[model samples]
Target: MNAFEIIGGKKLKGEIQPQGAKNEALQIISAVLLTDQKITISNIPDIKDVNKLIELLGDMGVTIERLNKDTYTFEAKNINLDFFQSDVFKTKGGGLRGSIMIVGPLLGRFGKAAIPKPGGDKIGRRRLDTHFIGFEKLGAKFIYDSKKEFFNVDATNLQGAYILLDEASVTGTANIVMAAVLAKGTTTIYNAACEPYLQQLCKMLNRMGAKISGVGSNLLTIEGVQKLGGTEHRMLPDMIEIGSFIGLAAMTESEITIKNVCYPELGVIPDVFKKLGIKFELKGDDIYIPSQKHYVIESFIDGSMLTISDAPWPGFTPDLLSIILVVATQARGNVLIHQKMFESRLFFVDKLIDMGAQIILCDPHRASVNGIDKKYKLRGISMTSPDIRAGVSLLIAALSAEGKSTIFNIEQIERGYQDIDTRLRALGAQIKRIEASAPTH
Candidate 1:
């Protein structure tokens, strides 16, 4: 275990490029197992989750060539289909939520796949019912009991059928999409997660000869290809990272530039933050965050309070709610943050409240943050990192606090973002990565 110690109340100013998205990289890595030809992916983030998936792929005998930092070539000339029931599942799978997707491709190509209870943030009960439903629709059968926490799936001949997922579960949609790409006939997936990550996955599959229609929309039509060829692809920059940097610059009141952000597909991020009174300039693909002093919450013409919440694709992502909540603490007015996706996400507001923030946890999924502006400043406090987004949000909060702050349970943080501390440190953030406790000699 490791912790981040940060000395706060300093202006962090500089240019920092966020690594490739961890969520996208996970699916990209898993897609390698779908083909036997060479697949070259560049700008891959070297984060913990990606590394763990890479390790799992290696265990399956996927040949990998490290071209250089942030780039890798993968060829699955001969993949090891023997995914044994070993300590590997318990020790590794629980840490990676994306490991659950491996079951789809494995079952599609090899007829049988078993994944340990997939691990991820403990934010709430993110259901896998949709995943199982889609798998079952595609001629696969799943066997799992939550009490014992075991998962396995098998399908001899994947005859494609229509899959209407209960909810557009991101990983679930991805898993089904991967499996359906090689099925016997066409597969129609409705209510699919069309986030940029899923879009990239579809595009990659399409480039590999899979017929896919509607890459960025909820309705996806897939005509199974007999075989997929090796195709090179690059991942889109992380939307959450884009949102985090925007919130960071706003909170720190620093002038910064974020490069290579895809503007057309930002999906309400700019407009959502604009509602919070955070302003920035867009030059081509780069975003310029100027040093802002007074952040006033934009009131509606009706003269009521402002409320922001998350929704599905083309909607504001739930991942950035924590970051937005943290930055809103220093703004000039009040705003309500409603995180509808996951339960227990707003629970971290207690830590921010302890740091002299004016916040009221409305419920498990909602919080009312009353901004303090420059009149009050947050002081350092010790806290635990509960999940990925919450952990990074706390880090931002700690950085803007008055004194030194320590954050434990940071392995959760590493699961999503890549080298967050190092990137922040490069921009004058006083943060240090240290062990949680010393080992006995």
Candidate 2:
């Protein structure tokens, strides 16, 4: 148990750089297992979840050499198949949702893969049905052990086939693509997730000799090859963090420049923040958000309350809804925040309400925030982080509030953001990390 003590009402200045995409890194790191040669990756975030996956890979005999803090070269030539049967494998594999993706490359190169049920943010029901169904479509036998809560997939002689996903699941699409890259025939995936992460995955696979088309579209075609060689990859900056910084700048009336954002890859994020009346200038690839005394929430064309919701790629991401909700707390008007992807994510509004923000939790999936409009500054209180996105949202709220605020369970925040307090501190934020006293059993 760790916590952050933050003194709010101080404007954050200077520049900050977004870390490499966490979701993309997870998928790309898993893809490293597909080849035995050295695959070098740069711009990797030094975060907990990524480190956990790296440790899991090392335990499985993948040769991991750290070229630097943010660069690593992995060689899976000497993977220990027997390690898959160990308790350490099951325990570590079940710790992060991203670990489920290893099944694809494992089944492709080693003929079988097994994992305990994967864990992640408990905001909603994140099912693995899409990943398994796609694997079964590509000639894999899927089995789940009821008693042990483990899943196994065996594809000794995989042959590609057509797969129309029930929904466009990002990890599901990435998993299936990795599996299909080394299969025996052509594969077609319809309604596949085409997020930039998936596009990067497709490009990296292609660079390694996998023939994949429709790199950034709903339909993907793959001509499976006998094998794939190693390649170098650099991950895109995390768009979700960029969105959070935009919201933070507006909330605190801070002039902050986010650097090297890879502007073209940020789809619908800037527009979504624009809807909240945030003003930012793009200088090449940098996003400069100037300080503002107040920002007004925009209404629909019909003068109705604006609604900020999430959709698949080409639409606003669900990950930033929490930041949007928190930023709206100080905006000039009312807006509806709909988190369509998750059912439990909006419950954190109670903490914000306790801190003097006017928010109505409409239901499990929606929240109505009546902007304080800077009429009065929010007063801080003690609260615990609920999830990754919500944790950062709370941190933003605490930074903008008037008094001192303490946020507990900060590990949830660190799982996503890399040294968030340290980074924010560099930009003039008053945040300190304090380790909690040991718990007495």
Candidate 3:
């Protein structure tokens, strides 16, 4: 295992660019399987999860060519369907949560697909019911092999139908949309996830000759075409990372400039940070955050404590709630962080409490933070990262602490962020990666 050894209390300054969107890359890369021609994708983030998915595709006989450090061309003209039954497939496919997406494209183009139970962050009960249910609604036979812990779906003929999703699950919607785009008839999806990731997918599909409307709304209409062609796509900058940079600037009292952030696509992220009293200027396509000695949280209009919660698109993102909670530790007022999407995401607050942050974990879903207004700096401690978001949150807290801190299980953090330590070091952060010995049995 590798751990991050950091010396805190150093102000970082410089320009950092957010990587390509991880969530969107998962969907867009999987979409390449829908067409036999070469599809070029640019701005792909060099992260573990995304790379795992790409490697899975390559293992399935997709001809992948790396045009540059961040660009690739994938041609799925001769995919090996037999590989799905191999043990190597089970091990590789089961390791990444994004592997679930390939099933939709495979089932759509090849009439069948199988995947081992996917693994990802141990945040909460991330159910696959949404994906399977959507596939079943589109005339596919769904099966779960309990013995092998695998999911299988096959369709001789897919006929589109109206699908009202139980929830606006982002990955579920993307999977269903991929299958629906190749179905025999029109498919209407209501209550679909309308995040920019989905919008980019739909637009890319349209460019590939698939007919899809309602690009940026909860309702999507797809007119199935005979087949899709190849198209090029450039992923948007990761909004989660952008939000993380904002919170990091406030917590560390650092002056940083985040370059090439798609400002308009980051809906409500800037405003949400502003509500936490973090100030920044949007210049051209960059976000500039100045060093701040103190920032005060804003209260509600009716004098109630400000309650920030995650919702579907156009609302605050759940991924950044951890960042918000961490940033609130040094603010001037109190705020309630309601993590509605995931029950266990707020559990990492205990580590913050250990660091001298005044946080009350109301429950598994909510936390109330009383900002210390920089009266005292957080003292560093050794801790283990729980998930990607919480891992980054702990790193942020460590960056602003009064002494050295060690974060174990940094693999969880590397799964999302691309070269995080190197990027932070560019801004003068005293952080380094060290390999840790495995524990004995």
* lDDT of each candidate versus the true structure: 0.85, 0.92, 0.94
TM-score of each: 0.96, 0.98, 0.99
Screening candidate 3 with a backbone cut-off below 3 angstroms (N, C-alpha, C), the clashing residue pairs are none
Across residues 1-441, which tens digit of lDDT does each residue of candidate 2 receive?
Answer: 689999999998999999999999999999999999899999999999999999999999999999998999999999998887899998998888789989999987877888889998989898889999999998899788989888877899989999999989999999999999999899999999999999999999999999999999999999999889999999999999999999999989999999999999998899888888899999999999999998899999999999989998978888999999999999999999999988998888999999999999979999999998999999988888989999999999999999999898888999999989999999999999987642332
Which pairs in model 1 have colliding backbones? 94-119
What's the true lDDT of residue 256 in model 1?
Answer: 83
Ranking by lDDT: 3, 2, 1
Alpha carbon lDDT of residue 151, candidate 2? Answer: 82
lDDT of 1 by residue, 1-441 (tens): 688889998888888776787778888889988889999998898888888888888877889998988889998878765554666665677667888878777866777787777777889988878878888899998787677577767788898898787788888899988888888999999999998888999999889988999888889999987789899988888889889999888877778889888878688999988988889999889888998986888777898888989998778899999999998999999999999989889999999999899999989989999988858778998899889999889988888788999999888888788888888888899999887762332
Worst 10 residues of 3 by lDDT: 432-441
Candidate 1: segments with Cα more than 4 A from true spot: 145-148, 436-441
Query: How much is 108 displaced in model 2, in angstroms?
Result: 1.5
